[model samples]
Target: MHTPADSAVAIQGLHKKFKESHALCGVDLQVRQGEVLGLLGPNGAGKTTLVKILTTLLKPDSGHVLVNGWNVTADPEKIRSTIGMAGQYSTVDGLLTGFENLYLIAKLRGVGRRTARRNAEDLLARFRLSGVAGRPAGTYSGGMRRRLDLAAALVGSPPLVVLDEPTTGLDPESRLDTWDAVGELVAGGTTILLTTQYLEEADRLADRITVIDAGRVVADGTSDELKAAAGNRLVVCVAEDHQLDAAARAAARATGVTPMVDRRARRVEAAASDGPAALGRALTALEDEGVQVLEIGLSRSTLDDVFLGLTGRARHRAA
Candidate 1:
């Protein structure tokens, strides 16, 4: 068993309530030191509440909680000092230059004027914001502003960073840029609790993922482990859109599972119990039905499948 001493963040029997809504119910979670832990859940899944508690923004009704070896309720100030938070919305002032934002945050963290300036400069360089550091943050692109916000969060070199959907509403290119920035943080051994709607982001960055639903953790494991437990996937692509129905039926028949159809991709996928054997059967069925097959394969399950299996929300190609 792991103790709070060994964990970057730990909670047991955590509960939170708001009016008649039970936001979190007996939720237990742990994030190891130096690991990126992806906190995943649907909307109202207590993700934000849990983050709030961990970051000292909110208190849990009843539970034992610790961050960086400090009790959350007893040492809320200490916990706050060790955590850096970047939420979905940009928090930087539009009127301030990127350097000013970071510098101000550094000063707020209680560093001396000289140290604060140095810290701001270092962070800007670290996050690739130095070239535009002098420009007003309002003039920065979405991705640049996000990078700036992230830089401000690191001003004091907090041990743990909490990112609550750091890439929301970003264009595809901007999203990729933010992912790269997060990757750099992971490489530097920062413990991160990241909550995101992008399943792919969790799959790419998280050393382990904790899935919560209805205010409780339903699954916790590495990406591969979660995907493996979800079962193998049988995928088939048809050459024509009209053949999609036939392909889906063939996959379902072979895998003994309902298939998910993606019309634009002309693809049908489902969980398969027998892997390669199911692929063979699917191939035979499609051939017999004269459906032109573009691609067919049996592979390990993706994070998308794991998410769908746990949440029961088939958000096709979850953004």
Candidate 2:
């Protein structure tokens, strides 16, 4: 929940369009101060559009957007000064060294030369790019360049940071580093609005998640809440190849739902409200029916399952 004073960014009935395509449809969002709110969806879901509106880069066709208590349309400059933005693509100057890149951003933000240099060095050190601070961004690895770009965005130390798919192309290790950096920023009281296609990233970092689809917010809540709303857990067990179908039928009869068979592993899988208890009952049913169960276990639904259940499309499904 967001109170007026606790909100760092707020949107009410936001709408936008490009010819026949509606980019946003009466979208509403609220970001509380010092919280990381993840905006998640497939491509063209309007995550970037919402970030642009909040950052004052693009105007909404209708509705109101406020950042740090200032209306974006009427107070763009004030809002800009209080927020930092890093887009999906790295924006660092390729010819400039890491330190130079940060220094340039600090200068552009109106910091004096002495202060800019200090800020640049401090950020480079904090992001663990100090050793490569002298190397041109073009010469750095993908991970290092990303770190430098993130450092540049933080040179102003704004209260809110907007990260749009900030780890899109990085390796797993680099992504973890970026996650650590974001965690540090939020721990120090900076609010973050992260737009990402990665469900695991959102599950790991976001205090709340907003899932947008076709330019509208279809779902919004903490991860657990969303999972609960999506409903049902599935328990699976492997049986002998000859008894697989029989076991599945027995489980289905016990759970009152059709069991799915995994031909490759000779497994029986079924969905139920209570996974553990359901698994126990399923095992008992199989045993009573003279069916042998090789292995069985209960597991909670994943964010992927929730996404598929809500959107009728897997998170990784093509747009």
Candidate 3:
């Protein structure tokens, strides 16, 4: 039996398909209690399908999914009782006022009338929606609607929360607001499973990340770990038009790697195993070759680089 001290969400040999399109293929993952696990993939990578199965909205064709020690298929009701979810799109009722929406959910969850009212008010305040709590949800901006949707999900104070692209289509400020709200939830001991297209969001929020590609698990690790797996850092140098070839040769010699020259950017870049030490050597080589450096910098692999390295394609590339 799983416990709160163990995995909050676990899947083994999971597979799902819709007619000819395979959504998940032999997928396996575990989200530890009180930890944020980011699910990342390109479009059609089955992120939404996985979230649906966990929330009891969809049944997996083949797999074992356990939520807080309860089998998803065998005890869906029990699983639902422990999870809160906010999807990519807002689930808020357009005609209902913000406070009314939250109150309705609280009441449905068997909260007392007085406690429901208090919870509704507190949620509105927490989401910064109190000023317009009486207004119809349809009248709110995209950001406000998202905040309300997330607040509604938290009305029962569930121990597990599933957030699927919760910050999609929000302004920068509102995205940060949602990030702060997520942090608060984690602080209160909620385990989160987040699916997002935003690498920076995953970097900032998730303790670990699972990346899927072509309906299969391609990579899983902490941000730094994945970045490290993407291979060595690179030092890039831009040279004056006449010195471009010379700089490229110098960089290749310094790093002992083939250099890629960007004609449009007037830049030359080569992988460097020694990071700053490689940069020092490259600068010396450039000076020896009489290459006039316009700009020079060392850059480590980012999550994007890691994703591309594993998937053989960029995240925005359609599956």
C-alpha local distance difference test of each model: 0.88, 0.84, 0.86
Please write out the lDDT profile of model 2 over residues 54-153, one tens digit for every residue.
9998989999888999998899999999998888889998998888899989999999999999999999999999999898889988778778777877
The reply for model 3, stretches above 4 Å from the true place, is 1-5, 249-266, 273-290, 293-298, 317-319
lDDT of 3 by residue, 1-319 (tens): 3453599998888888999889998899899988999998877788998999889999999988888888888999998888999987789899999999999999999999999999999989988899999999999987888889889889889988999988877888888888988887878888899998777888999999999887899999999998877666555556467788998899988899788788888988776768888888988998899988888887878897788677777767221
- TM-scores of the candidates are 0.89, 0.91, 0.89
Q: What is the lDDT for 255 in model 1? A: 90
lDDT of 2 at 30: 92
Clashes of each: 0, 0, 0
Query: Which one is best on TM-score?
Result: 2
Local distance difference test, candidate 2: 0.84
